[model samples]
Target chain A: MKVLATQTKSERTQAAILAAAEALFAKNGYERTTLRDIAALARIDPAMIIRYFDSKDALFARVATFDLMLPDLRTVERSAIGTTLVRHFLRVWEGERGNSGLAILLRSAASNEHAAKKLRELFKSQVMPALKYAGADAYAAERAGLVASQLLGLALCRYVLKLPPAVTMSREFIVAEVGKTIQRYVAGDE
Target chain B: MKVLATQTKSERTQAAILAAAEALFAKNGYERTTLRDIAALARIDPAMIIRYFDSKDALFARVATFDLMLPDLRTVERSAIGTTLVRHFLRVWEGERGNSGLAILLRSAASNEHAAKKLRELFKSQVMPALKYAGADAYAAERAGLVASQLLGLALCRYVLKLPPAVTMSREFIVAEVGKTIQRYVAGDE
Candidate 1:
């Protein structure tokens, strides 16, 4: 019982550190944010962060681990795939799951070379697989690039840049409009 | 003749400073780069930068003055406006004009609040007016936001992140595919 209690407390500390790091990274970006800032927010010793994550780079990697959690597109109706994907992304970015990881990655990717590399890897690993799974056979790579351009663009404008129209746009409207673009990229003929 | 020689030499110095500032800002971003670095690259005294541009903020603003140079779209056949705009942007980004100003702005905007605000203003002043001129009536603002999302996303993926597929896709292909989306945003019905 004593060991179990200690493990649970450690887990809570890890979670708190991660949460605080995500908030700071998302707000101030990677280079500007320091481990001390995270430690102060998490109410822990700065050394505790290094103990938990080894380094700032490791901690940021943990914070930026984004799983698209894309639904099995094969199961989604063919005609609805575009709308479905757009809807899923909107949820990933703004829905209950919270977008701190994505926000941190994107905000950092702009100026930090390492973060930019990680984002490129995420695009290859997560986005490419989804497109292939949905039967994008021949030009799958190109189509994935097209879809990414629209989706990432929307996220940048709405979430990061806070462009008024993109921020204020109704979720349904975005789904319909951007959905059409995604559909063309995914399923339309060249 | 003596006054003209002095004036010409000052103008040449100013142009050299601006060019060097643009290259450094595009390469190192806003925060990480220092006036010392700019001075070193421009081969001038650090105080000369202050004398010419006043401050780093002012220097960056001068470096990021991107004129989209979008032609009046009202004259083009409605179907071709999207293609024309995309083609123009391709030139602006990768063609003869060189994209240093745009690259500097976009690279900095990701992490800098001031640059982000300038991007929003550019979107409003440059992109919106072009769309309005193209007859994007009721949803002009929304359409402009959508257009900015795609174009900026393309720039981020292809230029900043250097995602392979986006970077490798042919200029004609990008114009064709992204143009269709632009057409829908600018002229298509809801």
Candidate 2:
């Protein structure tokens, strides 16, 4: 019973560290955020972070570990794919769960090499496989690249840069406008 | 004659400082880079940077100053406007003059609020005026926002993140693929 109790406490501590790390990374980015800063925010000894996560790079990898939770596009309606995908992304970014992992990765990717690599990996591992639904055989890679550029660009403008127009845009408008662009990139003829 | 010589030397020093600041800002980003670092790279005393630029914020504003040099889009053939604009951006980014100012802004924008504000200002000042050619009227701001998303995303993927597919795409291919999107954004029926 005591051992189980100790394990539960350890797990809680680990969770706290990850939460603090994610918040700091999203706010300050990878290069500027330090283990000491994370530890301070987590209310734990700095060494505790080292014990749990091994290294800053490792901690960041863990924080940035996210599943796009991409629905199998093969199952989505052909014409509705674009709107469905856009709505899904909206939920991923603004849903109750929040998109801290992606937000952290994007915030750091501009200046941090590690974050950039992870983003590319996410594209390969998550985005590429999903595009198989588009049935774009020879142009699959390019199609996926186009989709990424539009989605990521929307995220950058609305969330990071917070450009007035992008920020003020209604969800319905974004869904209609960006949705059409994604539809073309994914399914339009060359 | 002495006064004229002094002014010439001062102008030379100012140019050097701007160049060094641009490089370091592009590399280390705004928050991490220091005036001392810029001075070291420029081979000038730190105090000289202060004398020339006043402050780091002011120095960065100067470094980030860029004119998109947009063409009068209304004059271009309606069918060819997208290709013309994409070609122009390709030149701006990869041309001999280089795109250091824009690169510096993108690199620093994620983590620095000031840099992000500067980017929004650039979008307002340069991009919006150019989109007047699209004659979007009621949808002008939305149209400009969409254009910014696509172009900035291309820059982020090809230049900053260096995503493989985006980077490997040929100029001709990019012009074709992205040009269609921009044309749709600018002129397609909502």
Candidate 3:
């Protein structure tokens, strides 16, 4: 019973560390944010973070996991696939989940080599599979890349850089317009 | 003649500083690349950089100009506009000019606010005008934003992250495929 109690507390601490680390990493890009800052935000002792994570880099590796909870392509109507995907992504980014994992990955990928690797891994695992499922064949890999460029670019301009036009664009407008571009990228000629 | 000689020497110094700054900024990113490092690379006194540009921020502003010498939209065949733009961008990033200004901007924008601002300004001045010139009136701004996402995303993946699929794609393949997406973005219906 005592060991069980320790395990529950340890799990709680790990969850707290991950949540705090995500918020700090999202608000301040990787280089600027430190493990101490994450500990402070999580209201835990800094030693606890080091003990649990082993090191800042290791903690970041855990933090960089970008499971996007992407909707399976088989479930959506063929004609509405692009729009549905766009809407789903926007929902994930804007949802109560708050700062999305993809956002943090996007923010840090440019500056941190490890984060960049994770970002690429996320794209390969999460994004490419969906495109393949949606009927992309030999060129699915390339088509998925094109889609990434568009979607990632939008995230950079709209969320990260806060460019005026991108910032002001409504969700409906973005879904309709960017959705079309994504549709072409996924379904268009080779 | 005496004043002209002095001006020429000053211009040369400024050029050298800008060149060194761009290379360092691209390689190390913004936060890690400092004025002392830039001075060492340019083989100039650190004080000279301050005297000429006032601050590292000022030098960075001068260095962030992303002039692609974009072809006049009026001259290109209407049907081939997208391919032409994609080809031109690819050439600039991969050309004799060495590290493209856009590449540097992209590398730093994620971490530096000033760099992000410069990126937004570059897009506004360089990209939007081309879309307007191509006859996109009502939705030119939005179209430009969409186009920015795809091209910038390509730069991030191919140049910044070196994603395998993104890096290996041939120039012809990228231009043809990405061009179709851009064509639709700039000319497609709402």
Error of 2 at B87 (Å): 1.3
Ten consecutive residues with minimal summed lDDT in candidate 2 chain A?
A98-107
Ranked by lDDT from best down, the candidates are 1, 2, 3
Q: By DockQ, rank the candidates, best first.
A: 1, 3, 2
List runs of model 1 lying over 4 Å from the truth. Answer: A1-34, A37-63, B1-34, B37-63
Candidate number with greatest DockQ: 1
Give the TM-score of each candidate.
Answer: 0.74, 0.74, 0.73
Q: How would you encode candidate 1's per-residue C-alpha lDDT over A1-190 as one tens digit per residue?
A: 7764677778989988999999998789777899999999999999899777756765796676678888888898888889999999999988695446687678667656767888889998889988886754688899999999999989989988888899989999999999999998998753
Error of 1 at A155 (Å): 0.6
As a whole number from 0 to 100, the lDDT of residue B160 in candidate 3 is: 85
Q: After superposition, how far is residue A128 of candidate 2 from its true place, in Å?
A: 0.2
Q: Name the lDDT value of residue B149 in candidate 3.
A: 79
Worst 10 residues of 1 chain A by lDDT: A97-106
How far in Å is the alpha carbon of A162 misplaced in model 3? 1.8
| Of candidates 3 and 2, the better by lDDT | 2
Best by lDDT: 1
